[model samples]
Target: MDSKIKISITNFITVIYLFCFLIISNGTYISTAAKIFFSILVFFSMIINYKKVFNAFSLWLVIYTLFVLSSVSWALYGEFARQSASTVVYTTICSLAIPLLLINNKKDLEFFYKIIIVLPLIYYIYYLIFYDVPNIFDLRQDASNQIYNNIGLYAAYSFLFVMIYQAEREKRNIYYDVFFVIDLFLIIISQSRKSFIYIGIIVILSMILESKNVLKTLLRILLVFVLLFIAYQVVKNGLFGDSMKELLLSFEGDASDSSYVGRMNQFDISIGLFNQNRFLGLGIGAIEYVCRFVHGQSAPIVDNDYLDILSDLGIIGMVIYYGFHIYLLIQYIYNKKKWNKKNLLFFVLLIMLFIQGFLIRGYFNNYYIPILLYLIYYDTKTLKQDDSTILET
Candidate 1:
């Protein structure tokens, strides 16, 4: 095969892997599909492009190893352990695949970005127009699927990337701008306050750190605040429907509400679990086990990431996970000294993501973290700006 053809094939695989990850049914089968495709692509790319592995191994290979080990050791339930191991390996492959198999040059980055930039926004729009109730885009308070929030996260990330591309090229694509508006509108409508807050932080930090155009940044900030105010008014006032209005206002509306009290009560119970197993934790999968045992249920419905980690992996997992963030911070700080503007903006965006991971429950979930890990690895290794370099397949 021609070298360019081979590279294009690999790039296509990378894009497919991402698409499958983000757009598939969020079905049990979807993850199996991702796992299979990622495994094949990563192995094929590794064998073909053996050299990049050594070059980029310093960035992510070790982290992958540690995560695998920890997940294996911590997962107490047999099934959960197996699933956790599967998830960790899948993510590791995806994290390494981009830099190793595809994205060897600027064109590769653009190619990858072009695909990524739109799908997430489209997914959000689909929900906004179709699945969502008339005029309401937010997920309900009881929403627990990792996929929904991951779409929002993906949208936020894509918007930030679009902004960077716009700033860098001194141009604006109306499509990206439209996606941004739709994404924000959907976020508010979905009533996912965490997504909005995380995006807000990233935007503010990026504006402060990267954009030289202060007036533009200020205008953007003003616009966001105004939109947020409008969303709050609309949601709080129940403009969409009584159920959604009640849902949005539920967080602050009633102390006696069962959902509100239940989460608070669960947190209190988790606090006791944490106190008992402060360091080693209850063992991997222990929370689910305990929940099942206590509630006579098959799975623990724990939504808080902090409590989940503490209960399942104990303090050991917490330390290593947070340590990973510290390492990422060091990488960003080091890069800032050398300072590529796009990279700096990415670092700013990631910092918010890391913070949000702790503050929100979705961070530890397999869907979004792997993508974030892939970006970090890619940023760490990609240096040259050439657009035509063929990737290895």
Candidate 2:
């Protein structure tokens, strides 16, 4: 194939993949169908680029997949176990296969970054015009929580991409700055505390990684916060102010907050389940059944990803599961040669994913695929020469 045609084909497929992911994140009616279609597409991509995909596959990923699949033998709910295993397979294809096959160079990566960043801005504009503006003062509806959460998550990603782009291009574009501010606004309005925290952590990490002078960076950040505070004072009497207040008050609530307390209980139950099982575990997809049978209504869900693995796959599973992430982190750190934008972006992403794992089940989440793709894409590019030499040897 001609190089241009190949690039065009890859870009088209990437667009489709992004669109399907957007639908999945937003909980659209056709999300499941989209997932199935995209999964098929990913499968085809894997077959078409089997050599590259095989070369990129790490030992840890193979081990992790086998362990998850093994859970089916001991899974209490066979159907759920099957679904869980299928999710693992789908995630592997999307995260590992697609990037290795389609995104082979810098141009492909830049194109991917641009689309991913713009996606959240588009979604935010739609929500602002159709939903948020009309119901600015109304309490946030439960049904809309997922939409808000998705927006916040996307916005966080947009921030990271914008920062990376700015750093790489060495240009201070006002448009990216505006987009980042919008992202912060969306995160605040969405009241996704975890997303807010993740963004803050990402920003701090980005500054540290990108800055030459740590003291100067800290001062600049302080100044930005001061400006934000002043802006808040000016808007404190309006609808936005009320929303901000509500968000702040959310953190002050007592123990009666079932959502907060429930998560804690779930963690406790996960530990107990791990203690009882200790080795292989009750199996993946066994959480709901175990919670209902063993703990009754006290612990119905495992929200933390680490805890979920501990309870489902036990000690062995947890080691494999977390060990993969640890290995990746070490690899990125060890490979750090320059304080370039790509390196900074990779560090920020690594920190965000690591922190997010504790707050939610990061393994099979929608964001997981994109994070892994970014990691793998950069890893390949950074180590291309080393990889080739090793293969030649």
Best model number under TM-score: 2
Question: What is candidate 2's lDDT per residue for 1-393, written digit by digit as tens?
Answer: 113434477788777666666634434655567567666776776678666655333445667778889988987677877877877766555555355544777777777777767877677666666564434323244335456766777788787777776655645666667778777777766656566667767766665555567687787688668756664564444444344444444456645455666776777778887787878877776776667766686545666777887778888998887776676676666666533456657667767777887877666445444545455446535643453222110
Best by lDDT: 2
Superposition-based RMSD of candidate 1 using all C-alpha atoms, in angstroms: 6.5
The TM-score measured for candidate 2 stands at 0.78
Give the Å error, residue 159, model 1.
2.0
Clash numbers, per candidate = 10, 0
Model 2 stretches with alpha carbons more than 4 Å out = 1-7, 25-29, 55-60, 125-145, 170-172, 210-253, 291-300, 365-367, 376-380, 383-393
Poorest stretch of ten by lDDT in candidate 1: 384-393
Clashing pairs in 1: 74-284, 75-284, 76-284, 107-387, 137-189, 137-190, 138-189, 138-190, 139-190, 281-314
Could you give candidate 1's per-residue lDDT for residues 1-393 as a string of tens digits?
A: 112433477567766667666666544686677777777877887788777777433244455346545656644465766665555556566667666666677667766666666767666655555453333344654454544665667667777776656644545556556767866665555555456667767766765565457787677678767877886797678675355455565676665445445566666667777777687665555565566676554235466677877876677777665565566667766545455656666677668756765555543435556456556656644433332322211
Q: Hey, what RMSD does candidate 2 come out at?
A: 6.1
Query: RMSDs, each prediction?
Result: 6.5, 6.1
